[model samples]
Target: MMMRSSPFWPLFSQGIRHRVLPRSSLLTPRRTVKTLPSFSLENKTCVVTGSARGLGKEFLTAFALSGARGACIDLSQKDCEASIASIASQVQNAYPDDPVPELRAYECNATIESDVKSTWAKVVEDFGKVDVLVTAAGIVDNVEAENYEYARWRKMLDINIEQGHFVLAEEGREMLTWHNIQGSIILIASMSATICVRPQKQAAYNTSKGAVQMLAKSLATEWGPRGIRVNSLSPGYMKTDLIKGLLENEGKELVGSWERDIPMGRMAEPHELRGTIVWMASKFPTKPVNPA
Candidate 1:
């Protein structure tokens, strides 16, 4: 049995009512000071995995074009050298007067955590800091689910899911935190994460990309408070080394099927993603400070 409260108990006679205003009424107009940062990589240092060829090469070239120094990390030092040379020539030709930013190449197996760490350490020592990281090392297998070997599936998981989703995200975050730099991390996911390609059953590839998408979301949430922005870019079919096989083979019917679904009705060229890479590396526009 509970005892009754006295009549003099200090309860609010107004009943603690809240005045709920209409949504539109609550939106009062105010003056704001907006600071819009330029989408330029003027003084940034960018680290690009799989920078030997294909999409990685495009990213390296794009960053160089935007005035950013680049570190090309790939399995083959020779290929990395070629990529760096090409980027230097392109930048020199594009900006005849402007000094070309320094570009270095490192032989790194992105799937190996130790290799990645040492390579990043070398980069930081050489460049002072890394303002952006692009994880573009990945592979695709077109084997059917039933016929796909366990070893190949493991390889896919290791290269795609583990390297970008785990290794790069963690190591890059650590580097950013240590340098107190608000760095940008860009992971390459594929549109296959959304729609499965017909006539080609790459179950392993599709699942790995789906995992990469989720990994980006999770890393973004965890690192947002720390000023590190993690994002995933999902391009549809691109005319890169990864898809050369399908494009060259008797995939006319499959290509038609994909084209019909795409609004662009065509595969993207690797260089077309340059603008996006620049935008990602730049600081986002500041939130306006509203005046009363």
Candidate 2:
């Protein structure tokens, strides 16, 4: 037997009510469910500058692994072809049953505007369209700012900033015209753009990379409404041929000091950035959401 409580209990609970809900309703989610966005680059055509070697080749390999048909652009056609062949072999081995994506080599001096235009046109002719473009053709040098030669400084800016801009512009024209295919453009900047690297002076390189980041921001704003996404990838120190050479020549002690400063206590491998490159090239949301 249960004892009755005070009648005031009902009065105190006037604003509260309880109702039994169906088990199915209780189990159901309130919000609509959605599937995850795919990162596969199937049926996509990609163009990568500096694809002959180093980080550029790594980026191209990432795209290939994602099932993208690619055009490898570099200063030497032979080198580009060799890189593509290596990539083809790797891709085939990875996807033993699947056919390797078509990969072609293209030669172009990115610093030259006319050369960039012709090479991009040829790429479009061969691949029909470019869905993604990664401008990785750049060089770095270490020299004290005061002693840096004017010619060397000019060359640095020409190759990194100017060349990247021209190649990006040409790709933009191709994407905007012809079939008006919306595309993604990735500019490979550097961590030095944000922070001054120590133990070595690369004022020109850092400045150019900073400009590359700014260029991406400006283009993203200009082309966002047009369905093109432009972004810059600023990578920290990676173990590439360039960095390897530096470590060997600059002495292990000096380079090792910098390596110790890294959060991981070591330099990143080239393959570590492959996922990032693939994600950038793949279809994903590029729009900014309003907080309001």
lDDT (Cα atoms) of all candidates against the true structure: 0.72, 0.76
Which candidate achieves the best TM-score against the true structure? 2
Alpha-carbon lDDT of model 2:
0.76
* 52-167 per-residue lDDT for model 1 (tens digits): 89998999899887767788878876678778878878877876665667777777777777776666666676567888888898998888789988999999999998777545
TM-score of each: 0.82, 0.85
lDDT of 2 by residue, 73-192 (tens): 888766876788788888878866666677777777888888887677667755678899999998888899999999999999999999988888888887787678888888888888
Off by over 4 Å in 2: 1-37, 288-292
TM-score of 1: 0.82
Q: What's the number of clashes in each of the models? A: 0, 0
Measured over all alpha carbons after superposition, the RMSD of each candidate to the real structure, in angstroms, is 20.7, 22.2
